[model samples]
Target chain A: MTGKLAWTKIALPLGVAALLLLAWDAAVRVSGSDIFPRPHEVLRGIIQLIEQGLLLKYVVASLFRVTWGFTLAVLIGVPFGLFLGWYGWAFQAFNPMIQMLRPISPIAWIPVAILWFKVTDKAPIFLIFLASVFPIAVSAIAAVQNMQPVYLRAARNFGLTQLQLFRRVILPATLPQIITGIRIALGVAWLVVVAAEMIAVNSGLGYLIIDARNAGKRYDLVVAGMVMIGLIGLVLDLLVRQLEKFDEVRWGYANR
Target chain B: MQANPTVQVRDLWMSFPGKRSGEQVHVLERINFEVRQGEFVCIVGPSGCGKSTLLNIIGGFLRGSRGDVMVEGQPVAGPDPRRIFVFQENGVFPWLTVTENIGFGLLKKSEPERAKIVAHYIEMVGLNGFERAYPRELSGGMKQRVEIARALAANPDIIYMDEPFGALDFITRLKMRADLVRIWQSEKKTILFVTHDIEEAVQLSDRVLVMSKRPATIQTIVSIDLPRPRDLDSAGYLETRDRIFSAMGMSLRIGENEKEALPISAQQPV
Candidate 1:
């Protein structure tokens, strides 16, 4: 019953989007503009990219960079976040360093990433990691610092050991915040991937964009690549939303 | 020296490190109190007083800078399952169902025993039909009953509640007060409850310990001396309630004051 109530609101918008897709295809055919290719042509372009193995390589390259960078960032960022959130001294130690450098873009890090890592794949990964790390660190810290002290008390009273408290109560309690950080960090990850790929990497959707623009072969292909990036991003966001929903069900708003 | 209470608090002191300034600020001092076996001691004071702090110290949720609290004549160094606590904000874990929460303490018991205990408390709290219901689905009074049942299922000798009903509306709060009194009288568990409301302290407790402002010292402790199933309209209830308020630096203006004592009765409905 509750599920029906939640899903009922989606019916109208979904129908509208389906209707718009039909309208867009018809309008493109009727206009007869060389520039306004049909949506089917874009769909065929997507299939051609896939069949030529070009799309796969770029997708693989982008995924590899994103996955490794995100993993490393989590490895480095979570500890920093947990530490910062746990104590006053941790923040005092890292705040100035993090804040001073935080505002600098991931694109800015591209030159440094290339210089520091010397143009290897590590360079782009490093930039992506840099982009993703801070939000996770900051949010993790915020989550832990803001945690309602009640959960701690509840845990202690329930025979949770110090380790158990951190694992069960503290870690789980900070997860919603950590998830928020991860979600925000994902945007940075995607942004860094495009920028990093454009300058340093030999292949990726970013590379495809720049390469196509230089060739002037098809702006639609460039748009197609951009759309694919956006579509993947939407999936990532939805994945995070689902995870956060599960966490919220397990705890209440993660309280901090 | 007073035959050590089931729960004894001696000269408990706690102070806060003032935020932003790192200044030392005393919150409670010179606090001496005890809760005998099955005793109901209510502590009341003005807002900012350390009533909750004192309760937390006794519960071992917070450490007191001075003195100690003994439960069963053993110094309480940390939280113990044998001593349960119910707080004003929802203490029931949101993830757990009514049955799961009531059975929270029964984890130490054998599986069958745990089930039996859970079943008993569900019936006792009149929550049998709603065993699988999550706390978010229940009304406030129902949630409080589950906590009360949860504590009872643990068979804890004492319950340290810090304004368990303070968040509820007046009607709900009144109903909860009645239900709590009924539960306490039947179970006869020691309860050290903290509140800022004098009437609540008076209606529910055998004794009310009123604390002064921050660096809170126990200004006074009033034994309600009112009988079970206390009549809200009776003179004895009004007198005790007024005394607690006057100690709290306010007199009752909303409710009429009484000067005559009503017949006291110990008979309680099952």
Candidate 2:
């Protein structure tokens, strides 16, 4: 019974995907659009990229930028957010500025990024950081603000020092929410990295799409790049979600 | 048995700022009580009667608007490790295993000492074989046990519980009360418990302090002189419970002469 259930779980999504691919192939054939590639043509395009050794290089380049940018946001945004959350005065003073910056899209910063970094990988990396940092920081702040007051009271009753309270009580209590924030920030980072790559950088999946269209109108390769981005984004999300499985933070999540 | 008092409150008063500016809403008014060393005292009152406010003041989590609160002849400047407060809500660290939570206050102790103490309390609280379980894995009663164990493991001179078992089911609450009495007998720690349940107040306390309604004051302090594991059906138990009920201006019989409720002053223990 267990085996059959697991089989169905895998089979259901695959069945839907297969149907979608068939529909796409039929649409391409009936339309007879020379530029629009069929599903098999996109598959061949992916194989072609792999055979040319460009697939691994491009995928690695995109992932590297996302990693650096997302990691930087986590390192800086989390502590800053925690500080603001802990100190009401700090939040009051800085919240306006954060609120102002948070609404401006990372794509809106592309011109500024180019002017500062000048066609380097840093330009896209900077954009990714800008996109992801606010979500992470805001989530952390909300986590701390919404924490159970009873925990703080209990911690104080135990005579924990301020530093110890932050490290032991505040940090652990807010972790589940902070992790959720990080997951959202990662998604934003992935999105901004692609947009940044399209304009500012000469490598990665985003560049692959633009270069295919500009250089040869290889719609098949463009679709292949798009597919790769979607797949990689899914994998990154799945990896970060695994953090919620830890015993300490598991209480924050609902039981399935 | 009249040893030195562990906690003494002198004409304590507490009030919060009203919704409108420059107005005050009094909670506790001229509240005075003394808890002897190793005594189990329960403060019972109406739902909003400031029993919890009194407990919080004694616990040093909140300062009274007026009056002095002394613990072991020293003023309660703030929450000290020597005294712990158990909240009505589940306060066990969700991230921590049972062992870690119980050992939370033992950060200054050596690893071996902490482990030994945690293990001892786990056994005492009847949480054996569940050392690795987190708060989420435990039942309500078991979680309360973890909290009580945590408070005890801290080795405090006093434990102030604000309706610690108020959220538990009927059977679990009864079992917890018996277990708590057994633990109190063995440990002999001073406890200042606040609850609205008259039966619970009577069942657990050496003395039950009945408080009046908002801007609350101690209406009466009823001494429960019954033995441990006291019979609930006994005349003495029922009399004491009814006295507290009457002291709160409540009629013992349902839909009876509500007008015949005794005045608060008449119910005071001589």
Candidate 3:
């Protein structure tokens, strides 16, 4: 019965997608214009890119930028967040700057990033890092702030030392929330990577879209790039969602 | 020299500075008590009467503004592992399974030793089949049991519990009280439990410390001489329960400051 339900769940979305594709095909054919690519044209464009080896290159480039930027963000953001959450004075001193910078868009950083990094690989990577870090840090801080007071008291009463307390209680207690923060930041990072690539870098999925349109108006390749981006983003989100299912972190998701 | 009480609070006074300048709110006032080794003591008071504050002071989680709390002749400088506290059911760590939660304090021990101790407490708490379950999977009663087991696994001679079963439903509370009594009898740990439930105090404690309103004082200490598995409907039980009620001014038409001893037989359903 569960298997049947799962199959239905898969079939339903596939059916909708197929219908959308059919409508797009009919619309393009009726217009009698080749400006807008049909569904099969987009598929053919993808196959052409694969044969040319550019699809894998562009995908690898985008993934590489995202992985580095997101990794650096996590490494810096978690500790910075824990520090701010642990120390009140530090939060008070720097919170205004963090809050001020958080609202600015990664796209807004494009001009500054290019000037700072001189159109190198570092510019888009910097933009992605900047875009993702604050959300990760803010979520980590919230995670620590939202901790139940009883856990700390219980930990201290159990004779945990300063180091032991953080390692045993604070770290484990905050991990589920931190993972959630990282997941959110990963989404933001992926978004920033594409936008950053559109202006700052010359080779990525985002670049592929602009290049396809501007180079020769290859609308089919442009549509193919969009499809790939959506599919990849969905897969990335699913992978992070798996982290929330871990036994130790499962409690956070239980009530929800 | 007489051995120091298993737990002692000497002229304890705890207050915190109020939000307004030069203002203070007295949480506990001139509280004094001692629990002999292997005794089960419960402190009972009306809601917001500072009973929990008094327990925190004795447990070394809070410092008294003007007094001393000594356990085994050593003054409480800070929270110590030798005196573990069991909080409300929420005290059990949600991140840990039953075995891990129980073995938390025992982590410094050897693996085999920690396993044995964790297994023992899990069995003692009647959570034998659920050792691998996290606290989210447990009912309120079961979570409290895990908290209690966690405290026991620490091997603390004195366990301070703050409203440990207050969140449980009526039937669960009753069962927990009985389970606690059985555990106490077998373990022989000195327990200091704070609660607002007089019936629970009467059923489980060796002595009940009745406290007054805010800036609370230990108004009276009522000892229960009844046998184990106390009959809740018996006249003796009802009388003791009503006496505590009357002492707390919850008896029919009794004022909050009423001090006059009342005849137990005169008690009616409040």
Candidate 4:
């Protein structure tokens, strides 16, 4: 029964996607446009990318940048969030700055990133890091502040030391929200990476799309590139969603 | 001097700053009490009468402005592991399963020791098949059981509970009271429980400390003097329950026996 359910979960979405692709192919054929690529043309364009080995290189380049930027955000943001959450004065002092920076889109920083890093890898990486850190840090702060006071009382009553309380109670109590924040940050980082690749650097799915359309009017390659990005993003989101199944953190995600 | 009580509070006063400027709202005033070793004592009062605030002071979670709370002959300064709190099913860690929560305080112990203690409490609470379940998977009564088990597994000498069964339904509350009595008989821990339920106090406690309305002080300490497996419908039970109600300024002699000379509203409080 479980196996069948799992099979259906995958098969149903794939079936719908195939139907959508067929409809797109039919629509393009009926329009009789020489410029518009059919589903088969898009497939051939992806095959061309594979034969040239650009697919692996571009996909890996994009993924590698996202991974490092997100990892750095987690490292810096979590501790900063814990500090801000735990201390009243720190939160009060730093909260205004966080709020101010949070609203500015990472895409808007492209020019500064290019100027500062001078068209190197650092430019796009910096943009991705900036896109992710605020959400990660702010959510962690809210998680700590929103914690039920009873948990702290119980932890204290059980004779946990200050450090132990942070490790045992505060971390676990705020973990579900922290995980949620990280997921949101990862999404923003992924989004910023594409835009960053469009101008700040080259050789990612985003650049593949723009370069295909501009250099040779290869709209087929552009559509293929978009499909790859969507598929990869879906897989990344699914992986993060799996974390919500943990027993300790499952309660927070029950309603969701 | 006199056999050192498990807990003792003298002239306890607690006041919080009111919403307005330069105004204070007194929660507990001139509160005084003592719980002997192995005693199961309940502080009963109307809602919002500072009974919980008094418990917090005695449990070392809060400080009384002008009084002393001594525990084991030492001035109560902060929360001690020896005095664990079982907060109305709210203290059980949600992220942890039953086994994990019960073993939480025993993190410093050996793995085998922690496992054994956790297993014992899980069985003691009658959660035989739910050893791996999380707090959200359990009922209100079951959640309270988990909280109690966690407290007991820590091997605390004293357990303070604040309205532990207030959120539970009538049937579950009755069952929990009985379960608590059974555990207390076997374990013999000093328990200081606060509640607004007169019957609950009379049924579960050896002595019920009834408190008056806001700026609350202990009005009477009525000894239950009832046998184990208490019958809630028994005449003695009704008498003791009525006694606590009377001390809280709600008498039973109003409509049936005597004329309603004093309106119940005049006697009882919000």
DockQ of 1: 0.37
Chain B of candidate 2 achieves a TM-score of 0.94
TM-score of each: 0.80, 0.97, 0.93, 0.92
Worst 10 residues of 2 chain A by lDDT: A247-256
**DockQ leaderboard ranking:** 2, 4, 3, 1
* Regions of candidate 4 where Cα sits further than 4 Å from its true position: A1-32, B1-3, B251-270
lDDT tens string, model 4, B1-270? 334588888888889989999999998888888889999999988889988888888788888888888888899988888989878647888988999999989989999999999999989999999988988999989999999999999999999999999999999998899999999999989999999988888889999898988989889889988998898789999888876666666657645533324676677666
- Model 2, CA-based lDDT: 0.93
Candidate 3 local lDDT, A1-256, one digit each (tens): 9999999999999999999999999999999987999999999999999999999999999999999888899999999998898888999998899999999998999999999997777998898899889989998888889888999999998888889989888888888999989899988888888888888989999999999999999999999999999889999999999999888888876465
Looking at model 2 chain B, report the run of 10 residues with the lowest lDDT sum: B255-264
After superposing candidate 2 on the true structure, give the runs of residues whose Cα lies further than 4 Å from its correct spot: A1-4, B260-270
What's the C-alpha lDDT at position B233 in model 2?
Answer: 97
Worst 10 residues of 4 chain B by lDDT: B253-262
lDDT of 2 by residue, B1-270 (tens): 558988999999899999999999999988888999999999999998898888988888899999999999999999998998888997999999999999999999999999999999999999999999988889999999999999999998899999999999999999999999999999989999999999999999999999999989999999999987899999999999988888888887786756555676877687
* Model 3 iRMS: 1.2
Runs of candidate 1 exceeding 4 Å displacement: A1-44, A115-121, A247-256, B1-4, B11-29, B62-69, B103-113, B212-219, B243-250, B253-270
lDDT, candidate 3, at B183: 90
DockQ, prediction 3: 0.71
Model 3 misplaced stretches (Cα beyond 4 Å): A1-4, A26-33, B1-4, B19-21, B252-270
